[model samples]
Target: MSGLQPITRSSQLSVEVVWLSAADGVLRYRSEAHPLDGGVHPDDAAWHVSGLTLCTPGALLHSTSWRYARGSVVLTYVALPDPDPHDTVAVPTDAVTSGGGPLHPSPAVIPIEAVAAHACRHLALLAVTDPQVAAVAAAESPLWTLITKLPCAPAGTLHPAQTTATAPHTAC
Candidate 1:
């Protein structure tokens, strides 16, 4: 076991960011938010979703999504471009701290596809190792089924998306 522990729990979800000592990297998991009796927006129904973010020192690596439906979870990782200037939210630096000096450099601009692929590989590991995650994968939720097809990699093997190579990779 990786000794996963919760670092924070907000009203919406619980988050964990842990160092995988054996893999020499980090793994983050955010639990799905509980579904409201009806939905957040009646006009547009909302389903419960969880997220994961993976990063190494000096970079914001990848982001992933897990959507809950039909008593199962659907997983997807996609590279999302930086938020528009108008949509940016300011974070108070004083409220943030990390054992690792600084995990991301200012103005980090990683490609979305790379982030997605990297997230896929990590999700694959969780699918096999974590019972909950495995159940989700086994359910084969339909979200992103037409796209984001990701093959499982050997445990502990870093995918190309984690490398600095410039070649484009498919999203997961």
Candidate 2:
């Protein structure tokens, strides 16, 4: 124990701001990275980052998942903008990969694209099941459209087209 080096790791907050182009129907997004401030809770950090970076803070901001990569435990969040902005970093939905399922016997390597897709899929489920989330989704046209396009899956599998019967409760 004396000679062995201590393991070092950091926590990160990864925010995915997803929105639809009002005119072209293109789904655009921006992925932001921030340090987890020791003074702030991860949830509060995610919301603060979302509000600061987005043109308009989304009505629906929620933590979607967490992953270990690059020597850090990344806390991923999904934020949906209420009013679509003119300029947004664009990534096609097809770019999102279905590379791994959560329940696979062996560890599966997942890419950032799949993570973003999962975030959207999580929100889509919330919109339907949570009354508060449903209201927010309904108020924002672009957000609602982007959400509807996301795919869902049953308890075991991960697919964009299907949905789970129950979803975790959301704060929004």
Candidate 3:
């Protein structure tokens, strides 16, 4: 019975993104609030986000990218704003559909460097906000171990000094 444990899907598993402003460096949880009130726009080049998606059997997806000079990250797939008409060519009116129409574009790929950078920031935030979790993370906990194993996460990114617990607490 101690071997491999049976896996089950849990509806309680969920995911959400935490956004940061590239302009002013403000942090906000993504929600229904208006962009002016802390919400985020998918196409806004001035915003970035970091989040985790937990799938069945323990899969995790981290959304982050390094292509932008400012280091932007997006958690979900989004349709980019259309290009300016002046930079486009007119399509033929006689075009026919193959099946229905064009397929949805794939989500943007995030580089490991960006993902690691964001994860480090999130860990620091958690340490500051929750002493309990911070204590666990600071003790070389499994969660911290998993973060260090991320294929994209660079070495020394999860150093103890960076993710150290801010509040005083007994070691577990």
Candidate 4:
């Protein structure tokens, strides 16, 4: 083990999970440290962490995207924990903009809020396109409401800080 050791993508795999819950007509989210055990898939790790973090079950766990950050390929996930707030923070749905540039050949630095926001936007897309996801969202009242409230635009189409309240959803 020295300074010149090479690294592969799999060697640096890790998971980062955002706990999201809808309350009072808005989405609230929180994230906690999740240490990974070797040989566990990132998505499964996210589910395990979510289970440990939230007591109630039935939270929709989905892997939205991956970003390179902190010297590792971080797989991001969102878990919807509702009917049991669990001290989450509220973020405006319109803050769904990526923090930095695209991760083509460089790692982009993204904040947790932005990550969670992106997750919500991704789910909103699923809500309309995927039948199974749509059914799940429909069953969850709060999740469905928040997903409906969000502008149904594919990721990267909407500009940053676009006021969703005044903007027309059809434009998305």
Off by over 4 Å in 2: 1-23, 52-58, 82-87, 94-109, 152-172
lDDT, residue 163, model 4: 33
RMSD of 2: 9.0
What's the distance in Å from true for residue 67, model 2?
A: 0.5
Regions of candidate 1 where Cα sits further than 4 Å from its true position: 1-108, 142-151, 154-172
lDDT of 4 by residue, 27-114 (tens): 7888764546788877778877776344454457788877665556678877776434587888656664344232243324567777
Worst 10 residues of 4 by lDDT: 98-107
For model 3, what is the alpha-carbon lDDT of residue 168? 62
Candidate 4: give its CA RMSD in angstroms.
Answer: 8.3
lDDT pick, better of 1 and 4? 4
**Ranking of all predicted structures according to TM-score, beginning with the best and ending with the worst:** 4, 2, 1, 3
Best by TM-score: 4
Using all chains and alpha carbons, the TM-scores for the candidates as numbered come to: 0.27, 0.64, 0.21, 0.72
Error of 3 at 151 (Å): 22
lDDT of each: 0.31, 0.58, 0.30, 0.69
lDDT of 1 by residue, 1-172 (tens): 1222323332232211111111112222222223343234411212112122233121121235342233323333322111111222221111211122123321123232333334545555556666655644564433222112434554235468854555555565
